[model samples]
Target: MAATHDAFTTGKDDGDLRRRNIQTHEKANGGMVYKIEAEDTKKLQKKSNLVAFLDEWEFVIAPLIFTALAFFTRMWRIGLSPIVTWDEAHFGKFGSHYLKREFYFDVHPPLGKMLVGLSGYIAGYNGSFEFKSGERYPEELNYTSMRVFNAFFGAVCIPLAYFTARELNFKRPTVWLVTLMVLCENSYATISRFILLDSMLLCFTFTTTLCWARFHRLQKESFSPEWFFWLFLTGLSIGCVCSVKWVGLFCTALVGLYTVEDLWNKFGDLKMPKVELASHVAARVVGLIVVPMLVYMFSFYLHFLILENSGPGDAQMSSLFQANLRGTEVGKNSPLEVAYGSKATLKNMGYGGGLLHSHVQTYPEGSNQQQVTCYHHKDANNDWFFYPNRDHMDFNPETADVKLVANNDVIRLIHAQTGRNLHSHTVPAPVTKADNEVSCYGNTTIGDDKDHWTIEVVNDAVSSDYSKIRTLTTAFRLRHTVLGCYLRAGNVNLPQWGFKQIETTCVKENKPKDVYTHWNVEAHWNDKLPPGEAKNYKSPFLRDFIHLNVAMMTSNNALVPDPDKQDDLASQYWQWPILNVGLRMCSWDDNTVKYFLLGNPIVYWGSTASLGAIALLILWYLIRWQRGYEELSQHDIDFIHYSAIYPVVGWFLHYLPFVAMARVTYVHHYYPALYFAILSAGFVMDWTTQKLGRRVRWSVYILLYAAVIGLFVLFKDIVFGMQGSHQQWRYLKWFDSWRIVDQ
Candidate 1:
């Protein structure tokens, strides 16, 4: 009776459990249980959303901290060491001129000065022609004020960089890294601390590129009005850049080129018919090429119209009037005369004129000197071609008159009295009272030497008298007079009389034999000669000597003779771009501290290396073979494209002032080449981030990139700043010394 009772209880328990299971299954099928779980799922969904929010916060929060850090870095000691650099002094002088209604030479485009002038006007500097002594403003409007103005622009660049990085879809870490580097870069930092146009130009260019990248990235989105808006902004920024410098043309060119390339690639993949492809190409040309150019032109037109209406106070100008006033207009010549100088009145003085004139040195009287004939025979009808050079003519040096004959010596004479070359010790016939009407020889000295008509070296005052002489109007003037530049009067007149002859002695085979009379050849005379074999004519002996010196330098051996200046990169490295005040910052006064910024070998080399890395990355992405492996997400790719293309191209474009300086001297050309190199580093870091991110985890990639940057920073410190003071080194490379303290 007890066993039976226990079984009945067990059976009852089983039946109750079965009934519970069946009820649960039925509720699930009816969506009742699901409804209950849905409540739990809603809680879970809320929790998941919270987790995602937290993750995003963690990711972006660090970058925000970094951004704040960058801001402080730029702002810290902003005006603490507001010493004016050489460029600052130049710009400051120009700003003062704007107040005085005095126009300085427009070596740089008008936009940068316009911005500086605006700053001056705000500080009560009106465009007044009031000052006679050149002191345009009172003490309040000094370099300090200008520096403060620069600081404002500097601050603006930080946010611009952030926007640029963000548009590129740069990872949080990448954005932070770029921001930090830009804020800390000595070049950008140093430029920002003074009233110079470079920083401002950079800001405008960066902003434009940012806008362009943003527009390109948003083009695929459903409601892509952002693309058009950004495109307009890009146009404006480009205009602003061009207003500051003509190089901005390249910025637009790069954009147009990129757009076309992208269109071709995208459409080519779709396998469209030939006619459709052509139509597509035409459409792309309209959208990317024509539209962007129209936008750029329109921006300029706005400036043009504004200047036209606003009268004298308007800073925005096309400089059409100024350009016309300054005489950029070239009078139209007959086609025959343009291609080949008309020999209608040719007498014994007949020579190949126009751009094709062969400029050969005439043998000086008395000595049997071999004439260095420049083979520059370019036919007007036929294109130029290659030719083998015959042996040099052995001139009888003992004779008073040098009779040069061919086939004996290595140097051959191709023609007589071609053109004047100062380095070649050749001088052309000077302007005479008869030829004084021509402006080409306006500053040349002319004297009639009894029987021998000789041109004497006279002051410019005397040269003007000779230039005004209508009788001696020499027609077959060398193109050097028109296109080739000449030496500055100041350079010709050495300030320190005792330091007249700066010798660059070339030690050949371990013995100093052949010497370059002027150590600064560019400073002494203009190097304007027609294209010829002599273009690449470096003395073989000199080349070998330089090679030996460079080898020693690269090996850490002292190459330069100066023990006191042993810290110079020249002493340890014989490189193309010499690191000294003589080459890099030629316009700056050598005695000043700013001179150190010039002729810096390490910085130039570093920059070059950076460019190499950038080119490699660009090539990697551009070519089909490498593109697949080095593929970047579209957003990242656009960023890479802008950063890689604009900066490098802009380096050349914005370098007009420096390139212009090259016509006057050699030093100003350094910045373009050097900056190209430095900006290249930024591109490399960016490319590496993309590359590493694709293969590994993003965190690991970020850490690795940072480590590489750290290594680069180390290299910059140790290698580039070898002789500099620790403070100066840090200040120059990394703008914030507090970073060192923080570290």
Candidate 2:
């Protein structure tokens, strides 16, 4: 009988597993032939069968099962809604902008939107649809393919959770519990089965967590190829997550904390050489910081390269960035110098500033004059002509000489659209009540000294000369000649009656360093002067990157819910864990195939309770430790740190930040935190079972599976696309505010 090389032994190393072979020599074909004989073939076969059984049951089968369940749940009937739902209207349009090669602006970074665009492009979409909310997709749009592509990320998340749990050294059954939680997460599936950014964000989020756990696990094999591979992948995953949305920064922060702790532990080792410590630092710098930054910047580089043509989002960026776009007319100027009678747009140099704008509609309160505001978008209202101050001699742009406006040049800015003169007075401003009210009171033919403003040119980084009012480069302050205040826009928004535009105010403080007081000529239009070269308006990439990020942050901050407006869908940080509300993804038409953002009761409630359970467990362990009682072994300590504490940290990082955010949040914002919570819940379930007997453990497992499966089925309609009427879903409504249906 013959035996295999491993000898079918379990738990024995290849070197230790003796083959038990007898070598004999026989004469054949005029040469000596060696043959090996096995003495214990039956034992070898038994060991081989045992090893196979362990591999199938413990290592391979659960992940495959979880993946299958995840994919089926996420991808099945994904296009059943067939309409633009929720934020799909916004993100879908961003995708179309990429397909059309047109520049667009959004609060999130470009990678996720680029991925969405890639899906639409692969599906043969023409980028012609408006993607209006509740609008049905075109017949040939192949929306299903795009949804399927996005859903793949959400589906793959199950296997990722399984691997992450295992890397954290969780038990096999515990790992299965975690994977099943993610696979049956109704809200996660529902959120991903659409052309939205959440799926990509969640996918990269899970990946970063997984990669970091794997990297930490390989620390014993420090500097190995596998270690480096996982470390590099962690960096790349962080980049992708952050590129999808800034929310991903929370997860990155978790990884960063872990790395810091790891390095600190190594720092305490006196046996470790200084050179090796330096190498460790360098490795982390390269892999964790530099690599991720490069990936993030690369996404922007591609974003800039692809969206070369100007589009509706042009105004959200700097005038120079807009000018670089193929068809934008912002800096394709007829003139470069700011001359008398020059019609131009004055861009506020302050962070998150916009163009000087005004409308004929007067403010409801205060001075009641025409509204003078700072608008972010481009229009005729943003244009204003620089005229000689009211006290100076009348100057006609048609017949005026080439008198280039310079330092201390008194000028009245006449709104090109409303023909109103930009004026300011001592009455308190609409939003910034501490500042003087700025309004458009007089016309070109009627005004006072208040309308006359002295241009105090600020010194340039390159040029000390304020003699020439240059386009783009020149930064100056407009001092209110009468009140001796400086005209400013500090990102403060007016009330809803004022159309929510930025409030233009005149500050009493004459601080030259205040960016809010600085303004620059953005778009110059003077027919009498010679045109400027396009090369002169070229902006540096680093400057553009920083500017765009600041602008995105600014816009995100401006998304606060209006107090007077009834925002039924907006949710709070506290409400999220409790699953206190749900959001309608589409119209509530009786026959419409609708979707809702709601978590499964069993999964959601268990996860929420698990958070408290983990906290209490930590408290109990700490009390015991303080009393010098050894309540846990080293393995238990490791499990607590890696499996329970890690996800708790992750959950806190993702959830706590939302509490401090001023931006309006939705139900979907909770899912990233929910991901970590599910792992913790699995840990709690495992911890409970570990203390119970075999019979009790089986009972717990059976009961848990039943509850998870039952709740999942109950909430299946949210992901599968609910049909019939809202009345049919009344029984599922726990909260009236959920608005799941009319009932």
Candidate 3:
């Protein structure tokens, strides 16, 4: 019986029978055990080693090959257009500003622009050219190097995605699919070939996700150096993400959610002690929260350090802040003094409200007085004179004792040119209909009770001397004495008649936390006082950083479009997932070098369909689990929950937030979300193939690959600036909303 068992196990051959075999006979039991000869064992071990070696090589070699292909596709013909496209104009100009050490304002945070500047400076760009959209790059400029810089970061996204997939325990085929999808996506290719922040954002996001996954995988070896390194890297990447755009907060929120879940998991583990769990929590807090905060602030430090000179962005900041910047009108150490009847520009201490302004235009339908609004730009219209109540008395600084407008003093602000007092009436504001409208009323040297405002110094005693009210530095609130309301800029923009400036309103409810009512005397003009001393002044970095963040938040909130206006490129959040609209990047009369920013229809639609499929599959799995009729293996369950659901969560985090936004959105806003959808598709396809016959699985993969490559080829001309004819573009246009007409 032992010989027969050995023969069957070794395969029926005379050589096998002659080979030595170890046989053990049981004394009590009736069974016999036999082991293979040494030679046979060595052969088996050799075969196992060979298989292992091949598997290792496949994992490394395949991904490397795919990465090379992605890089080649991303960089090929990248600079052929030689024209600024879409956001490249804005970002490239910003980069030039950085190189010139000139300050500029942008809706986005400064890190992305700083990186662009670094790249261009290294590439020999002299910071001399205006990067206006549709303008040709100078023949002597090495624009290709800057474009290549962006492409390099963009190319890194492919490998980062591959590593992220592998870290999530996805199979080799799944990783390959994700890499190919990113490589062939036309929107990514086009955007990467320009000086845009999106590619850098994508790179940071992917790296953060990869690091997060790696950290979790290394958790079993608790507190290992490798674990801490990955964890720290994740935090650093999150900082990079935020330093690019505010949208990166969504990614930070994702990591925060994951960390909470991870900690909860540790809490539930029976083997982990309370001390260990506390340590884990402490580590994550330091790594994720503290680390990211430091890095974000450091980026701002670099920004402030480099942009020491004032330029276009001066108007966006406080007058005192601008005075500190080199090349500004005021010297750095300008004295903090305000005199009665002094012409000045008042700034709202509220986050991003602008300088107090009054223009020739009147409120169209309400109040009918000269429109008093908060204009963001510095202009002559913003000039006003401070007077003592209805008397309109001017303080004699030379002959009489210089008396500052002390706290609790009633003051009237009169428009310098219009000679009308700043007034607030019971009439509703145009935009914020609930608040009383603020306007310019009564003629110079004469005013009604509506123009009288009592000054209440913020964070100061009522008995404080007027001399203590430092110009630009001190904050004060102006309360309308007649109406018993606080004067404020409510972030509501007036119509075109008011020059589209922010609405100035009077609110009855004085909420303690409401900063919109706070005001500061920004610029004071007095001929009596000697020119203020000029000292090399440095603005407080932390205060400026905080103020800048608040300003950015307020500015972003005010970016919604007017309901009466229409934007052809503006798309709804739902429209983005469906590819309903495409942005027009650049177009010429002859259609030469025309670049339209649109994704490959097949790729976009396919990813959308796959996302739906994944959702349905998750729902089915949940229903099956509840019914107890179908059961999944442990490995399958883990893959479904961790590997599949992770990317889906990221997709939702990045995409779903856009639904809440009222601002104009474009198709490119959906690219980050599309990445996760592609990953989900790879996971689903790999899972499906595992259940199919080998030939059928391979055929499905081959067909899908062919489709992606074919679609990319078909749309290559438009994305790569190959100058296709009108007839050819018409053939490629799959949707009417594409708006791909020849220019």
On TM-score, the leading prediction is: 2
Candidate 2 local Cα displacement, residue 123, angstroms: 0.9
Q: Tell me the tens digit of each residue's lDDT in model 3 across 471-494.
A: 666678889989989989866777
Better of 1 and 3 by TM-score: 3
Candidate 1: where are CA atoms >4 Å away? 1-71, 81-83, 126-138, 221-224, 263-743
Residue 571, candidate 2: alpha-carbon lDDT = 85
Ranking by TM-score: 2, 3, 1
Which residue pairs in candidate 3 have backbone atoms (N, alpha carbon, C) closer than 3 angstroms, thus clashing?
none
Worst 10 residues of 3 by lDDT: 1-10
Give the top-scoring candidate (lDDT): 2
Q: Using alpha carbons, what is the TM-score of model 3?
A: 0.90
- lDDT, residue 449, candidate 1: 14
Instruction: Give candidate 1's whole-model lDDT.
Output: 0.39
**Model 1: residue 648 alpha-carbon error in angstroms:** 7.5
Supply candidate 2's per-residue lDDT for 97. Answer: 97
Is 1 or 2 the stronger prediction by TM-score? Answer: 2
Q: What overall lDDT goes with each candidate model?
A: 0.39, 0.84, 0.77
